[model samples]
Target: MLISGIHSRPKYAGLRVDRSGTHHIILSDTPRDIARMVEGLEPAPGPTEVWTVVGACTVTAAEERGPDGSVVRRAFRSRPLMFDMLGHRLARESMGLRLYAIGEEAFLWDVAALARSFGVDGDEIQLDHAGSERRRVFCVHCRAMTENVRTNIVACVGCGAHLTVRDHFSKRLAAFMGVQADAEVRGDLPPVEEIFR
Candidate 1:
């Protein structure tokens, strides 16, 4: 269901550990993301630390042992706590620190934005997407965000307008733009489909 030729859509190039990195911080939500992020870097030159959210979706992020002698693992109760820890770590460490953000698009970009707040450029961090194609949609009429939208058309939570989720994505907003789908035709609207999975 992912549309090609959309420049705004994020590119999820697989993660490859930087050989020159002295320390690595992996932040992921799903086990798949963790495995993908740590695919390489076997016998890592430096220590690796994993900061993952142990929610209902994640059984145990600590089960993944790093190639570099047991990785220091920290599990959080929620995404906010995990991201808070990431922010603190980013604020403290600067040199020789490589960060990996792995999860869905929303989680990946959220990490990137937080890193930016601490003066870390997106280029400095490695991002690998995993799990779910659900989208956070931004309503054009009211500027309200409708989260976890898996269908093509949804009712805007803010203005009650029926919206068509567009492929055009906004990195700054961390959401796809949704436009009113039935404004011109009034009651006439296309059939909504659950394409994003």
Candidate 2:
């Protein structure tokens, strides 16, 4: 309904909007003549605050199964992941749409994507990049999958907590091996350069 006159711009794989004026936004595909009019026509608000939506995403074209029957893909996480998220967030936030997170602790922002698809002006999306990029710790009991292709942290839908790969999958293996469960992996671990690409 609010999608008219609101131009949609591609923010990475996501969407952004540019509002020209209150009159430009159309409520329907049909010409304004047949469009239903809502009462109380007031000039839309002025340039509100901007917001950002930052997240990691793995891009892969259709692929084939590997030797073990698992599809193979490229790893685009780490620095690239940060850059991608920043690009999309900046594009949309520049147009005055606030970034709203779908889940409190996850990268699932489908609602934000939908809002961007349909033009809806909103308030600020205060951006904050706190916390270190330390290795995430996944709960062994949570049955959460750790994705090495995209990011080090995985959000647990059950408990809404963030976890890391070693703290998760590798830890699961360690538990099965009857090894000590250390929050952080110790010596003999591969160098960071050799580990993450």
Candidate 3:
């Protein structure tokens, strides 16, 4: 149901009693993460449909095999297409679905966003990161989205303003808030340090 200050929509009532839906496993192109994800597939509640986005690399033999000898689905392209497939799957299957994603932070966030749009609660989704915490930042200046931002001090891709990435995360934007980094003193720049490492 509607929890105050939380979700406006009612909670999935069947979440507690229903555990028989298909498990959708979305994995990134990382080999190590794929292997680890495969190992963690045990104890799943029901039938699982696996999808992996293979970038430039090929999926290993082990990764090609599913949890119980079934063939895992493969998408040989970028993360955008993978997310599209996930969105379509979530649209087709509305209930009793669980999502398990293993990938980089940005990629996982993309999946989570799509899942949320399809009414999948956070508890129904599990995530694991295979890479560092490079973030996606939304610049308030020129209203542009910057990806793979690895530092607190980032140059706005749109306005060219040096922005300080804030800890605040916007679910709607799916990015961190960024403000002008040198607002106090126009030319005084903050000490640069690698963040989300």
Error of 1 at 102 (Å): 1.2
Q: Candidate 2: worst 10 consecutive residues by lDDT?
A: 26-35
lDDT per residue as tens, model 1, 92-131: 8868888888887888888888887888774578888778
Which regions in candidate 2 have their CA more than 4 angstroms from the true location?
A: 1-17, 20-45, 50-141, 144-197
Q: What is candidate 1's CA lDDT for residue 36?
A: 41
Put the candidates in TM-score order, highest first: 1, 3, 2
Lowest lDDT block of 10, candidate 1: 57-66
The candidate that wins on lDDT is 1
> Residue-wise lDDT of candidate 2 within 92-124, one digit each (tens)?
543433432211112322233333344532432
Best by TM-score: 1
Q: What residue pairs are clashing in model 1?
A: none
Error of 1 at 124 (Å): 1.3
Error (Å) of candidate 3 at residue 169 is 1.5
For residue 46, what is the lDDT in candidate 2?
29
